[model samples]
Target: MNPTLHSWLERRRDWLGLAVLCAVIFVVMPLAFDVFRLNLIGKYLSYAFVAVGLVLCWGYGGILSLGQGVFFGLGGYCMAMFLKLEASDPVSTKIQSTPGIPDFMDWNQLTALPLFWEPFRHFGFAVVAVVLVPTLLALLIGIAMFKRRVGDVYFSIVTQAIAAILSILIIGQQGWTGGVNGITDLKTLLGWDIRTDSAKLILYFVTAGLLVGCIVLGRFILRSKLGRLLMAMRDKEERVRFSGYDVASFKVFVFCVAAAMSAIGGAMFTLQVGFMSPSFVGIVPSIEMVIYAAVGGRLSLLGAVYGTLLVNFGKTYFSESFPQLWLFLMGGLFIAVVMYFPNGLAGLYDSHGRKWIARLLQGRRAAAKPAPGAAAQG
Candidate 1:
């Protein structure tokens, strides 16, 4: 085949793969599952945001961040602050000593909303903060570390430390951060009750839509010059740097992009689950997000989403059926994936599935073609 034709065919295949994923999320799953299960899937999809970001950061950029939950939590908390504030209107909290403050604040003996919480009352500001706060933090961390030449395991350790510190900070500040329980009972978004089944369904679609958008954006990035540069930097950072490229700048940019994506996931998670807490801001969930990317094939964007759904579904099933054995089972699954299919589900498909598909298509084409005798007669 001509090179141009091959490129077009490859692009067409990618679009087809994406369309199949969309059908599963937007059509098949919703039709098959009840609202409750669909809502759970939405929650699972929320985590896929992190996995997708991991693909760009770790798989392509070669920047492994174990503290992604920090950004995820920040985004969740930003949105939660707005929701919590709306839920704590003066009329709603009239029974509390602090009539216009969060219940946790009132319970903590606060007299008025803290200055920091005051701004979250505005929905517009909260929306911007959801994406901006995490990106800004990532920017700071990236500049500090990348510029200083921090890479490899050292950078990973630093991220893990950040996750631990942020979790502790949230848990320690009960009056403001909702302490160990984090933020709960988020009842409304602009006075539309989010707890309703209808609202949950809407939120699920919204999450799915955003996730699809993110995947597309990831695809675009990977196809661009920047994407090529990222791959180059990942494999040959010093060579690229010596070849007149600013390696640190590329690292920072991709890291910030990853942070923004993870933050969006966190925000959606809060919307779907009706709460945000330190539980998600810690080391464990951050590690789990990495597992999602790892299991999905970090180099494959759509694979990340499938990996997330598969793992979360497995987690739910095993936990409910064999609670005591779920952890061991999960560990075994990870080991199995690493040992058997190191590049993840996408790798498996690339190695075997694509070949099978190609052969099937070839066989069909051959069958549809007229025999030589029939062609001669015609």
Candidate 2:
């Protein structure tokens, strides 16, 4: 029985790690933090989704996309469009020059609704778009890049360029998008007052639950044969192709999946934060998203969550108190993490923390052992 339990621990330690993470996020955090702080954690957890996606796409699959924010923004904008439509119902916008259209559109002097936003009036379509739009965009991008054998630093550059293009387009087309200000003034979701404390608590729970689901999905992928193939492709793409696997297909799959995860986070961000912006869709936030993944231990899904929370919390605290020093501190933190803990926080825990845990368990096992004669009699 002891051996069986030990073997189980050896085989499924990652599951135990995930369970502990989920417990902290769902239980301990809610108990420890006030409503406002809890809500802030939820907002940070939204980026955790993107970081986890990066684990699968960049860490394991060797696809470093610098433009994950594009998917994040796309998903967010989809949700924002729906909420904006609901908020701009004729009665609410009666005083506007053009009632029933978004105020930004009115401010920009647009007389009619944009063709693209028409589909978001329905809640179901908006929800679907949150996932589908990002997935489709990623699929197209992946096909274009991967099919032609473009990858590594070049792929990263292309994605960055794509982010820049989207940000410029959104800002330039003020009548369609919200311009530099992006989308704002989002109020409700399916008649629920999203601004209320109770609603914020509920939304935090929803985000936590969804995040758990994504973690489970990532774990399943990582443990599967496809995951092995991804690692192999990452290390030796030519060898993987020589082995008759469709390397491009695997790359495309991981990229699209990552985009979907980021999109879901973006949608939730819109719900929790009450807005979407090109600022998040631009190169800076996108790279910061990568930093979140790197700091979390790119290979560890749970690490991503903790890393994002820690980094963002620090950013908030320092930017408020020592704004000028924040950037330098952030740079130093990144360098320290990379140089000393290449695998991020999770790697540190795995290397040192797990050794201590193993020693303690072994000591307990030794102490629990019965006398030789007594064991024979039993």
Candidate 3:
């Protein structure tokens, strides 16, 4: 093999893996699964958004965020607020005492839409908020933490606390946020009914496309000089600072990016799952998202997607058959992942899968050449 070809393959190997992932999710899965299962995959892909973000923030920058679900919930609630408002139009909510407020609000005896929910009445604003809101929140948290040079387990604890607080606030403010039930009864998007099978297929494709786009974005970021700096900062913060890099800014930037990505996923979740609730915004779900990233191999963006799907699939499978033992099994799986495969699934593939492929290629080349004296006989 030419040296340049080998170098190129080594550099572009992750890209090739990403391409294969896109093909499997977009082409193979759609053709293989029925509509119901395909929709489930779409929900799973939504979680992939957060996992991919974690690959950057945690895997590269060494920033572990346990409150990712806060961003996800923010994004979902933004979209949900918009859709809920649309569904609660005068005609639709004519039966309610407050003919234009959301059904839940009306049920709670509220006479008007909250001021915060007013902006989401515009579809465009809601779309922008999906990305901006979470990023902004992350920026604030990142600045506060990184500026003080807080890190590691302390940062994780702060994030988890945020998730818990947000969940409690949402549940407590029942009139504004639909309380424990969450913002449900979402029916349409810009007047197109989202409940139909055809609509579900379109939403699935959209979610898959967004996820692939994020992976490409992650690849670009990881391949750049900034990405190298992030890795360096991860390993040696003092060294990066001595080199004159703004370590805090990078940390904040990566955190915001991760928040934005998770937000997009949350918004898509609302669209596909037909609701947004505190159930997804709480500590347990936030930690579960982290587990998805961990199981997938935090260093591999594509692995995150696969990890989210596999973990969720296992949960559903085991919970249905052995509900009592599901938690124990999940806990054990996490332990094994930590102890045996610290680098996650992607690390395993890189260590073993690439070597296997190389061996196969070498064997093919050897077989193509004339063995020993066979050419002389000919």
Candidate 4:
């Protein structure tokens, strides 16, 4: 076995590095950046959950799911609906309320409220739906697709279609689903006023904590036997099947996991951004998630985190600085990274670090050589 593998197999060395990194982030973020920028950084970290999920689903499982945005939207919409209902409530005793007594009642002028939106007015129901809705949808879809033996390009295309169709449907429903505008003006989350800076800061810290938790949990999962089975299914489904393992169940499990994580990321994002829209979840964002994994080296966990940060940070800074050339710059960056360094940014980091350390060691050895022929003379 390789030396690295030999060391990793029996030791928990990965936790040391992760613990150090988390400690550094928690300490430095508060000191270095102002609250505003730190909050933005936290926003970036919220989506890190999506990165974690993609790392497992794409890197280990060899599954490039292109509809994570749909799962994300599911989570965001669930929360958004509840927040909107609570904000729209007319200070009443009703368990639930909508503007038009819901579709079933079909009241004119909406003097009452929509009944369909009743359940979401409560925080508990909202949270549950945000999780369950996406997970269930993913489970159902995964069963259908994996059972049919979908793979490669076809799997990607089908997922893309799911996202695209959902976006179109949301856009078409102008009255009920907020249409293109989406749910907005979120006044609070869990009874805390969202407009206050302190609340935003709290949200930021929460997002950071969630990102760290997800990364650790995902790392644990990736190191388990299930992770190995997913990889086996990815590499050779026929061989796995021949070995008597049911491949479809593994795929479904991974897909559902990815979906649940994406949904949670969406919920976190919506909370931070204070809104949700059809634009937030669709084909483009879904494709972007895949690109993030690919460009980050899908095989490496750290690469996924680094890849997402690098890609999205560029999008943020470049777009703000050069609105016209941002897309061109991103496209060029992606192509250059893919063509020249297929292993992504993490690989680049490790390779360069090794070279530097090697050079330093060589310098030390030269300094210690001691007049080359002294030993020979002795």
Q: Which stretches of candidate 4 lie over 4 Å from their true place?
A: 1-13, 91-112, 354-378
Leading candidate by TM-score: 1
- What would the per-residue lDDT of candidate 2 be over residues 150-267, giving only the tens digit for each residue? 9999999999999999999999999899999999999999889999999999999999999999999998998899999999999999999998999999999999999999999999
TM-score of 4: 0.86
Per-candidate local distance difference test = 0.94, 0.93, 0.92, 0.77
Per-residue alpha-carbon lDDT of candidate 1 for residues 243-349, written as tens digits (9 for 90 to 100): 99999999999999999999999999999999999999999999999999999999999999999998999999999999999999988988999999999999999
What is the lDDT ranking, best to worst? Answer: 1, 2, 3, 4
User: Candidate 1 or 4, higher TM-score?
Assistant: 1
Residues 1-378 of candidate 4 have per-residue lDDT tens digits of 345543553374457546655775678767888877776776677666777788888878888888888998989999888777666643532433343233222222245555667888789998999889999999988988889998778988999999999999988875667778788778877677876778778887777777777777777887898888888877887998999988888888888888888888888888888888988689998888877777777776666766777788898889999999999999999999989888786577556744564567567867988885897798
Model 1: residues with Cα > 4 Å off, grouped in runs:
1-9, 374-378
Clashing residue pairs in candidate 2 (N, C-alpha, C atoms within 3 angstroms): none
If candidate 2 were superposed on the true structure by all CA atoms, what would the RMSD be? 2.3
The count of backbone overlaps in candidate 3 is 0
* CA shift of 39, model 1, Å: 0.4
User: Under the 3 Å rule for N, CA and C atoms, how many clashes does model 1 have?
Assistant: 0
Sliding window of 10 residues with minimal summed lDDT for model 3: 1-10
User: Which 10-residue span in candidate 4 carries the lowest summed lDDT?
Assistant: 100-109
